[model samples]
Target: MLKIISNQDFDTFAQNAKDAPRKRSHHNLHEQLDAGVQRLFISTEPETYMRPHRHSEEHKWELFLVLKGQLDLLIFDDEGNVTERHSLSPETNRAIEIPPGTWHGYACMQSGTVGLEIKEGAYIPTPQEDFAPWSPAEGEDGANDYRDWMSTAQPNTK
Candidate 1:
């Protein structure tokens, strides 16, 4: 069956995300497809902490489109230095494609934010080597500061 996404779906997703322990939820769009490509609707609250990591496999590019609310796509260097940031919203550029092996993360700028994500996948665990060593892991004491910096940081380079 073809999946349909209406405004109601987003509203429900947003509510679920808020209720989730981690302040995040996902409505999988390709549940039945189950192929190389994975697609889904992600709902995230402002408290969501997306750890800075990368898909080291060259073919694993990921794309994101903001459907509601605001998000910041943060690109970092190997040393956890901010290299670029995209403030994504319906009013601004709402889409981004992160290249494979590029250290990146996202921070929700508004509560109940929703985004569509598309990427190649085989449901494998992300390797430790792909996680940014310079960045704090999720739940670490410094993770909040890192997430905050990603949310408000300005682009330092093109």
Candidate 2:
């Protein structure tokens, strides 16, 4: 069977990062995709920041196709160090494969930046993600704390 989801239908799946801790993963398209693959729609503001964390179970990778705006894909090591960064813009359609156990987070460089995320999954109850110790847990500190860490934290030598 062949299926086609229009822009309207896909937008319904998009989710907000701010509501994630409340267990609201915003506009996600997990059910629409086939097994072993889940699609998610992510939209964020400039001040929005996802705390540093890692998914160790699945080979967690994502293809972020920017629908609009800009973002910074910040990757970290086990010690919560900023290892690499990617500045993503809507100028191109691209995908970044993030390996499992790579601590990562994102900062919205511009408001209303929407991304289409595709990844492998068979959802589990517990978080396959391990949050970095040095990073503040969501709601514990303001977004500024995360930004500060990124600017000041030493890079991983490994």
Candidate 3:
């Protein structure tokens, strides 16, 4: 079956993200969790907080392409300092590739933000050891504040 990705898919994802408790949603394109390559469309609202994390597996480099709205991809150092920040939007910077073992997270800059994420995987979720020790976990008291800071975080800053 040929699955054509259309505008309607994005619209539905956006609506789902708005309704989700975490303010984000994912629609997997890959048929199964064990698929060699994982692909998905991620929809996120401005309030969504993606806790900083990394894929420790050697082959897990990830790519994200913004298809709608905007977001700021924040790359961090081991000590939790922002090492790089890339603002992505369909009209400007559109994509980013994060290497495996790199600490990173993103903050949605606009509502209805949608992006395509692709990575080498068996779709294993990030493990506890891969979550940045210096960052707050999702739903933690400082998670929102940390997410807000990421929206404007500069290189060399914590």
Candidate 4:
């Protein structure tokens, strides 16, 4: 049976901030047809900031498509050094395919920037991702520190 799952329907199944730990919502374990692709819909309220980090394996890529608002995509290196920064607006409707082994993060520029994330996935139990040591854990105060640093930090690459 073929069924169409709208973003609204997906949101019903996703985990909101109060339901989970993060500021946005996510829906994992989608239909089997979505295998190898981790689908997510991020809410834009509260103006969340993702800390710079990378996937553990260097073989997969994560694509972030802004479905609604603006985002500042920040790329960094192994030592938590910023490499590139991009200001993305909704007019382009393009997705940023972030390669593996690259540290990256994002900040919502508007009030309702919802992003759609597609990634290669065969969810693992441990070491699923490599987070920059300079950042904080999901619930730590370090998150605030990380955001402050991202605002004034300079790019590290050409």
- Which candidate number would show the highest lDDT if scored against the true structure? 3
Misplaced by over 4 Å in model 3 are none
TM-score against truth, every candidate: 0.93, 0.71, 0.97, 0.74
* Superposed Cα deviation of residue 51, candidate 1 (Å): 0.7
lDDT string for model 2 (63-90, tens) is 6666666767778767766788777776
Lowest summed-lDDT stretch of 10 residues in model 3?
119-128
Total colliding residue pairs, candidate 3: 0
Q: Is candidate 3 or candidate 4 better by TM-score?
A: 3
| TM-score of structure candidate 4 | 0.74
Error of 4 at 18 (Å): 8.7
After superposing candidate 4, which stretches have Cα over 4 Å from the reference? Answer: 1-21, 32-34, 125-129, 151-154
lDDT of 3 by residue, 1-158 (tens): 99898899889999999999999999999999999999999999999999899998888999999999998999899999998889999888998999989999998999999999999979877889999999889998898898888888899999
TM-score of 1: 0.93
lDDT of 1 at 53: 94
Q: What is the C-alpha lDDT of each candidate?
A: 0.87, 0.62, 0.92, 0.66
| Better structure of 1 and 4 per TM-score | 1
Choose the strongest candidate by TM-score: 3
